[model samples]
Target: MTAGTVQALVVCSTASGAVTSAGGPVSCGTDAKGNPLYLSTVQAYVVDPASAGYFDAIATPFDYTQAFGFWSVAFTSVVGLYFACLGIGTVVNFLRRA
Candidate 1:
């Protein structure tokens, strides 16, 4: 619609995720309850119900932190709809007689 809007679309669209989340640098896989299990610096992280905790040593084989889903299908669909509306508006304006 405007130069600034176009510039933002070109510059940030590729790099910025539709949605995002943040977590601590030292983190580990989530529990079955969907809660984050932070890993200890001393050892590898594990998912064992008895051992995993806010601050504790991990097993020899690291359970490893898992990335949660962030890609937004809804946001992408809305973006697509916005572009479609822009296209349609431009076409409609071009076809109209003064």
Candidate 2:
């Protein structure tokens, strides 16, 4: 979540039927017949430099224009609401004086 850091969702699988990571082989537990059980899982990790290029193609660019438009709309809404409340308050004050 920091600058220059790349996050990746990795699905661990083994062509040879043995899952592994940098530490060592990953295992869930033994089966009823005592065979080693491997579990494929979805894991999130910070991608290394070597694999960063693969993720670049899927990365989305920020849209500044759209963001600016949304900000303008929000500002306008707040200003309009303030003026509306001021006008209502002035009307109530005038009626009370009458």
Q: Which candidate leads the pack in lDDT?
A: 2
What's the C-alpha lDDT at position 3 in model 1? 15
Cα TM-score per model: 0.28, 0.42
User: What local lDDT does model 1 show for residue 29?
Assistant: 52
lDDT of 2 by residue, 13-98 (tens): 44223356665667666767777666454445566677677678668698899999999999999999999999999999999999
Best by TM-score: 2
Instruction: Name the TM-score of candidate 1.
Output: 0.28
N/CA/C clash count, model 1? 0
Estimate every model's Cα lDDT from 0 to 1.
0.47, 0.68
Q: Could you give candidate 1's per-residue lDDT for residues 20-70 as a string of tens digits?
A: 336433344566777655533222233444434423543344433322223
Lowest-lDDT window of 10 residues in candidate 1?
A: 1-10
| Model 1: pairs clashing at backbone N, Cα or C within 3 Å | none
